[model samples]
Target: MYIPKFLEKDDVIGVTAPSAGYTEQVDLTKLESAKFNLAEKGYKVIETDNVRKCEKGRSSTGRTRAEEFLSLMDDETVKYIVSASGGDFLMEMLEYLDYEKIKSNPKWIQGYSDNTGLIYPITTICDMATVYSGNIGDYGMSLWHEGVKNNLKLLEGRGIIQHEFDLFENEYVKKITGYEGYNLTDKVEYEYISTNKAENFSGRLLGGCLDVLIMLCGTKYDKTVEFVRKYREDGIIWYLESFDLSAARLQCALWQLKEAGWFEGAKGFLFGRPCFFMEEYETDFNEAVKTALDSLGLPIITGCDIGHRPPRMTMINGLRTKVKFDGKHLEMRYTELDGK
Candidate 1:
């Protein structure tokens, strides 16, 4: 596993739209807001052609976006690359990517959702770390929040990054007012809630949305048991999340991973909160997932606020994270390599 070092203050952060079409339809104000946010932290933001040219019907040519990403990776001055948003087209460009170039010059490739298709395979083939950070369309629109800014700050170094969620009664008001005024809770009672706080286990982080990972199965990007075992010689930690999936669908996905041998060499398992399909379903989605993971006898942590949630934290794909789960609390630490 290759541990890329945290970017320096002067390093340029490249922004691009590699999957979905942003083009002129994107909210320029939001993009500027994100740029200002990075600038306030004393970093440079470089927008790429991919962002400007991507449109719903007349987006860049087949491999244009992939080439743009590759160009950014090859540029020595661009230290970190962030996706503008998750879209439907990233998978088509995967085969055209320059893996060797990315492998040679590894840097942070950050995004979630459709970005997972790109990140998962990059970790497997290029041996470079990627991040599952929420995209510009979501958290980037509210860059003033401490949770959002601090999460970005955490990405600037090598250490375990720790955080907890405190949902507000009026989430909309709290979102507009900033997270500082919201009331926090320790009780785990909500329409959709899951929590896992577990022993310190160390491994290279690998995982993304359960649905996306499932789609990649049996393809070139699939991380089969044999593939994971080969990487396990170094160590492997898996993280997963789902959005509004049924308990049965979640269970089926877990079973698929189990059959593919994902659990065979996993050092630790981490899960994001599970949201149900509808309010009518009274079954506890968290408990169902916990039961599935428990059957594997692996050290598991549930209900982490890393996916499809407010104030989401950034998690690198191939980076080494030190995860400790006490009976009541869970902690995660990250360390970056000197030269990547």
Candidate 2:
């Protein structure tokens, strides 16, 4: 994997919208607050022209969004490029992007939710590292949680030691209410089930929102198999979360990935609390996971703090990592191994 340079203080951070554009639906106050917060941290925030534009479920025309993102990637002064927010149709911009150009000039770009479509291809195809964490609005939150702090530290080239979080925000806290900070009302709970014999392992980190990964399956953008094979020596540790997927849909997504050979050479699995899920008539989330993944026989840890939930941990794609869970406490250590 090709890791970009560690971001330094005074670096320029470019903000763009590759998915849904800004409109009355977006919270402008939170975006301004996030920009201010980022500037206060010693970095300049620059936004693309179309970030505020809205169209048919996209921030701008697919070509325009891709062009802005690629331009930022090629900008010498910009140390990082983060999406203004995640939306429903970022996948549409994939084809318009210049992957070869990106491969030649890899840079740090981070976001989650719909941004998964971008992160996965960048790492798997372009071979560059990307951060899967909060979006622009998240930084503007009134309270800076440990997860948010650690995310900044990681981007600054500092190592991170992640622990199971103490609290998480449930679905009741609607995302539309921005800048209030993460209202972690629910007690954090974790389930570390070692289906395999070993309880501890290490591998190259991969994965993103299940809702997005499922969409990339079988597309030309699907390079997961090749990526895993290239890094087969290092192995893969997949950490996935859902965004409003029902238990049945989650199980189906897992089954699709399994059929696509995504979990062929795996070491462990990390799951975040699903933003929204239902027991349905078939099974609950727990049963869906067990039934779908029991065949892999890997150490699977579920209900950790990650994805759409509040106080989520940041995971760097393509980073060599060490993970261990004792059915109670989960710990992770990230190391710079590729020397990029």
Candidate 3:
């Protein structure tokens, strides 16, 4: 994994909706606010035509979004790219992307959820680093204060930095802000289920939404151990997260991965918040996860500040990193190919 140069102040950050069409359902005000936020940080925000189109309730058949993304990749001035939101259309745009062009000129591509489909394939084929962070819609509208700061740091090609881990402890209740009920606050308190201490471990960063990645298995995008060894000789670090999957389903996925030898040469594992919607299934979820890991005999860390939560952190796919674990503290440092 090669690290690209840091984005400069003059660099343009391209924004577009590749998966789902935003249309009217997208909050225009929030988009505008996000633009202002980026501008304030000394970036030139560029929004593609697909970002503004109202194609709500219709299928995402437009290639405009994919075309715009490819165009941005070729443009030297565009140093980074972010998604408007995650929807279920990126898989369709995979074949249309120019992988060679992206490989020659790698830039930061940030988003989560459905965007994982694109992120994984791009990283696998191009060997370029892309970010898995919050989308544009939640820019100024959401208060992921730590996430935003960390994202900017990463954009500068800085190493992974440790952050305080706080758990979401309360139930998120929907409130009536207008005639309809809305969740005014996005912050949720959580407990520290587990943490990876500050330590150094280097490998090509890989993996994404466990469910999505699993679904892609046997497809071109799947990064099976065999596929990974072809491009990456150092090893790989797997990161995963899920919204509200049952313990049984989660266990089945883990078993499949183990059987596939996904963990054969992995350095470690990072797990994001595994939020189970059913209150009664919390213990089941914990037990299933533990059972799966216990059988692997690999180092595992859970409850990272990523996925379906506020204050998200970005993981750059294909970037080699050194994670230092010091029992009470965790620190991540990067290394240059020249041994810097």
Candidate 4:
């Protein structure tokens, strides 16, 4: 697997909206502050033409989004790229992406949620690693929180051993100052689903938002079966999460992925907290996961610091990983990485 070079001092970080662009004044303010913060940290920041423009929930046309992404990839100075926001239409721009060019260039592309449309395809089909983390806007907080700092540290090739965060945001809070930190409410716990006690397991890091991943399961972009098979020797540790999917839908989606052979060579599963889960038939998030994946008997860890919940860890897709869990907490270690 190809892992792009980590960020260095003075390297440029390009921001583009592959899914949706910011239109609200508060959003624009946060975006600008984020850019300024990165600049203060000695990294150059650049944005595409449509980052601040949104119409019909799109930054521009699909082709234009692909074009801007390609432009950043071609730029020798832009070592890393991030999405402006996550929305429903990222898949529309996938077909237009220059896959070959991206594979050849191999820059660090980072985003979460709808961005799975890009990162998933890039890692599984293109065979290059990508990042699943916060978008550029999160860094705009007047006081950078632990999540924001950890994200930047990861980009710098620090390979920090991310520990479980103390708390997580339970619900989405409206942006008032546009530079607000996470309104943390719930305590974080890496719950063991398949077993009552903690278990340690690791493999190639894979997975993303179920809402987006389910959309790509049968599409051409989804080379999941092939990708997992090819990396069977190392196994696969799926770190998954969901956004706004009901218990029934999540169960079906998990079944769909499993039937499609997406879980080939799986060692274990790590599930993050679901952003908005509509319980069905008295089934909760953990129950939905158990209803589908429990039969596998793999060491399933749930309620991790990942996905739409604030203060998520920086996840690297396609990297060999080692997860150490000791009942109370879990720490991730990357293999074949330099700066750990």
Worst 10 residues of 2 by lDDT: 331-340
Estimate every model's Cα lDDT from 0 to 1: 0.67, 0.86, 0.66, 0.89
**TM-score ranking of the models:** 4, 2, 3, 1
Model 4 steric clash pairs:
none
lDDT of 1 by residue, 1-340 (tens): 6555577788888887777655443355567766776777788888877675556632465588788888898888998888887766677887788888888887878888778888888887766777887666443454245456655665676343565555512122333322122233334222212233335678878888777788887787665555577767757788888866677778778888778777777777777765334222454666667656776556777667666554555677876677776655666767553232
Q: Give the lowest summed-lDDT range of ten residues in model 3.
A: 175-184
For 1-340, candidate 2 gives per-residue lDDT tens digits of: 7888888889999989988756764367777878898889999998899888877778888888899998898889998888887889998889999999988887888999999999889999998999899888778887778888888888887776889888888755555656687877788988855457355899999999999999999999999999999999999999999998898898899999989999978888898889888887778787788888978888888897778887878889998999877778888888683232
RMSD of each: 4.3, 2.0, 4.3, 1.2
The regions of model 2 sitting more than 4 angstroms off are 174-178, 337-340
Over 1-340, each residue of candidate 4 has an lDDT whose tens digit, in order, gives 8888888889999999999999999999999999889999999999999898899989999999999999999999999999999999999898898888998988899999999998989999889999999998888989988878988887777867788999999978898979988989989988787853435777999999999998998988889999999999999999999989999999999999999999878998989999888989999999889879988878888999999998888889999898888767898877656455
lDDT tens per residue, model 3, 101-151:
887887888888778888887777676777777887656544446566678
Task: Give the Å error, residue 223, model 2.
Answer: 0.9
Q: Give Cα distance to truth, residue 41, candidate 4, Å.
A: 0.7
Candidate 4 Cα deviation (angstroms), residue 73: 0.6
**Number of clashes in every candidate structure?**
9, 1, 22, 0
- My TM-score estimates for the predictions, one after another, are 0.83, 0.95, 0.83, 0.97
Better of 3 and 4 by TM-score: 4
Highest TM-score: give the candidate number: 4
> Candidate 1 local accuracy as lDDT?
0.67
